[model samples]
Target chain A: MSKRKLTIAVTGLNNTDNPGPGIPVIRGLRDSEEFEVRIIGLAYENLEPGIYMHDIVDKTYQIPYPSAGTEVLLARLEYINSIEKIDVLIPNFDAELNTFMRSADKLKKMGIRTFLPTLEQYEERHKSVLPEYGEKYDVRVPKSKAIFNASDIYSLNDDFTYPVMVKGKFYDAFIAYNTEQVKMHFNKISSKWGLPVIIQEFVKGVEVNVVALGDGKGNVVGAVPMRKQFITDKGKAWAGITLKDDKMLEQTQKIFSATKWRGGMELELIKTNDGKYYLIEINPRLPAWVYLAVGAGQNLPEALVKLALGEDVKPYENYQVGKLFIRYSYDLICDIAEFEQLSTFGEL
Target chain B: MNINRNIAISDTGFVFDPSSGDSYSLNPVGTEIIQLLKKQKTIEEIQVEIVSKYEVDDVQLEKDIIDFILTLEQYNLIENNE
Candidate 1:
């Protein structure tokens, strides 16, 4: 008897200077020995390098951007599903997750499965709500406020001080040393990513991240903590090493149990010089550095697929500590004709 | 106005500058304009070619070309020797 081959569609395939988690997630899926997989790359733009990585992605389809609304996205997915019969979809982008989560029921009706956090779980973990989330979860989070207007920067003195962090709702963050910088970043980020720019107290510490998976039943299936060894100018981890930290592991479990979170999550925490971990952000999806967890010993993407398939998976007890992941860039040689084909046909 | 000779502009709109090790992506129209620029085509000639092929007017095309050129210059892909 042979195992059934699963066709898994994945998004966020933009592997560039700022990479996405799709390629690494696909790598994890392909590395799974328990099941075979056929990968369908769901991309937003025709030029996303992962679309050209034929060795990893079986087929690539350019879907409409999330700004096109869920109906457009669902229509595109329906057409794609009619051809590929995608059994599971792993959406890795923060912006696209909302559309997918909202359409999860409809997608499930079409026989496509996705393991993701509930809308409530997703909303409560947003950067602007981190303070309340920390209070509710008994976690230590830096004081933060969401400001809709740049004028609100003048009033931040009530709760915030100089050199605070100004963050966009969806992306981008800057350390604002004064009210002018705060107003500048607020306008810049809000114009690009929309209103409700977040202002947070700057925690002076080293940043550590934990990638964990929960079963939606208070059980953390897998967790891996890593300290960023080298950070890029864009604040991305250029190199990271897995750590043997019980405190971080406990924090991950606490969040999972409290939220009964489903699917993959990356908890960004700042460890203060006083040896206390302050929660920074909770990315509702897997981090770009997820391959580090797969390398360290836990194949989380594979486990997530199994969980999505309704299989009972046991919790992973341990991972190899001190495992290092050094990120590198490779220029894939591809012809112009391929890009032209995808650009014209919207599929490759 | 000139494009940096070291800048490689592929048909796919992928741009790479060897000196800076910076890579960029462009839309199809942007790629076509860069290719024309590489051939030393004047802005007027490029505009005429684009307006003929694209469903755009001269005024809009001229405005877009200027904006695109400004973007290219911002990325250090263009050099103004004059």
Candidate 2:
């Protein structure tokens, strides 16, 4: 008997210096022996390298940016569906996931499936509300506060000290050594991403991350912990190696159980000198380094696709530890005509 | 304005600066402007050529070209003699 071929559409195709997880997720799907995949690459920019990587993307279409609202996005998806008929959609950007989550039911009615966390689950784990989340879940989180204006930085002396982490609501974070730097980052981030900027106590420790999938029923389908070996100036993991830490695995399971979280999530943790794990941020979607999880034996993206398709997927019990992933930039030669076509026609 | 001689730029807009070990990806318009800079074209000449080829007007092209050049200068991909 032959396995079925699936048409999966994925977003966040900007595989640049600061990459998205789409290419890595597609790689996981391509590596699956149980399913053959035809990938539809959804991109926001013409130069998203995945759009030109024909080996990975069967077709590429430019969608409206998330700021365009859900109506425009759904209309674009409808047109794409009329032509390609995508079976599943995996939106990989944090900025876009809210629109997807809100439109998930409409997408299902249009025959497009997605396995994503509920709106409540997504909201509760947001960076702004993470302090309360930690309290509710009994997790150790750094003291943090969300401020709407730069003037609030002056008042942070009560709960925070100098060298606190200044974070935007949606993206960007900087370690500020003084109030001036805090104001600078606050204005910079607020102007771009809008605020309530987050001020957090800087936890001195090694940074670690966990990529895990939940069954939405208090079960962790798969989990892998990795310590970043090399970090880029932008603070992305340039290289990472898996770790065999039972405590990390236990924490992942506990978070899943506590939140009943559905779909893929990345938990960023700071392990202090005293060996305590401090939850830093929770990304509702897979991280850019998810390919490392696939290499380590848990093909999470494949299992996620199956779960979205209403298939019963057994929870992965074990993965090979000590697998290393070193990310390198490759120059993909492409023609200007291809770029012109996609930029003009919004499809290639 | 002169492009850094050590910078290697592919047609696909992948830029590698050997001196800094930093790589960058650019859009088509950005790549075209960099190619023009590499050919030692004056800013006015580059703007005229781009405006004639692309769907942009001279005014918009002028502004865009200046912004692009400033970005290149910030990234240390170009040498500003001025």
Candidate 3:
């Protein structure tokens, strides 16, 4: 009788509020009865060592996260192999997407479901990559250039505008208000982070992000266009309002199709001073504001779980567009502390 | 660290003072830093003090204290005594 029910492994279960932006996915998975869920983590801070959260999980297992090269992901794969079976591998962090993307072929061979966007798709949505694609779509993106070296940056004079963005290939991003500032930032980051820096034109406007879940069959099932009011410590949008506009929703679909992307995606759109919508970057996974998507009406996690199990994907009723969500709780108090990481006594 | 006596709290995290139309989040660190700020420690003073006392680095400590106070000022947590 139990053989038919799916056993999904919810990895990175950090039993804390600072669990990046992935906590809501766990909550949504737990709320659904379709999947028999078990939580796997590196440690259980919520309980005594070797003891897991009995209330939230059917069973919990401890696997040490590896610090060495490929050890962490390998440890995760080994844990996956130990499981009865896996239906899906949901990456909870944008940083994890890189590793998860590389592991896609292996997971597919193992008969597990992993929804990773393609390299082209990733390039289509990345902040540095958006401007190039924006040209074809007639979508205005920040004036940008991908530099191969530090000298390429130093060669720039007053020809470039003030207040440009210094974007990293990975996580770290910064703003440079002048040539000296840009060079100073470049000097610091180029040595520390390695090469291929992106210098982008800065646009001043309201920052809006679009969250959408898509199936592999070229179908986008759930979506929300939102104006982010604040971002929490883990880069999660702490508070935002969903936009109620069919035009924005339609345009979002246009951008996805233009990119020929699959899986879940979020696009950061900057409305310029000229009333033009410029696609700044695309996050090929859930945004920090996904919980707000649930509040707005579409439960993307539930939809994603169903799709991963090889079940017939269902249509998602469009969620209310103008709903607002603000993350505030006893847990946030803890999350913000660890996140701010300010130099202060009693503030770590 | 002593907090300014007049800081008012709101349920939605909307902190304010009627004297000026300023707002802020006692966003955990903000809560802790405000306690320190009321002691009237300068930014560098707080950074040096925190690094010596806490389990953080010089760079991180400076960034955190400066950002925390800046956020405080943004939300009007630090007001004009004038």
Q: Summarize candidate 3's per-residue lDDT along A122-211 as a digit string, tens digits.
A: 766665566667777767678887776767776555446777878766555678886778777777767755566778887887677788
The candidate maximizing lDDT is 2
Clashes within 3 Å, all models in order: 0, 0, 3
Q: DockQ of each candidate's interface versus the true one?
A: 0.01, 0.01, 0.02
Candidate 1 docking category?
A: incorrect
Model 3 spans > 4 angstroms off: A1-5, A10-19, A41-72, A187-193, A232-236, A329-348, B1-82
Deviation in angstroms for B5 in model 3? 46
How well does chain B match by TM-score in each candidate?
0.92, 0.93, 0.57
Candidates, ranked, TM-score:
2, 1, 3
Question: Per-residue CA lDDT of candidate 1, range A1-348, in tens?
Answer: 566699999998998767889999999999888878999999998878899999999999999999999999999999999999999999999989999999999999999999999999999999988889999999999999999887788899988878999998878889999998898888899999997899999999878999999999999999999888888877888888787677899999988999999999999999876669999999999888999999989999999999988899999998877678998888889889998889999999
Interface RMSD of 3: 12.5
Q: What is candidate 1's CA lDDT for residue A262? A: 99
Instruction: Tell how far residue A226 is off in model 3, in angstroms.
Output: 1.2
Interface RMSD of 1: 15.0
Looking at candidate 2, what is the lDDT of residue A34?
A: 91
Instruction: Name the better of 2 and 3 by lDDT.
Output: 2
| Candidate 3 residue pairs that clash | A342-B64, A343-B61, B23-B75
lDDT at A53, model 2: 97
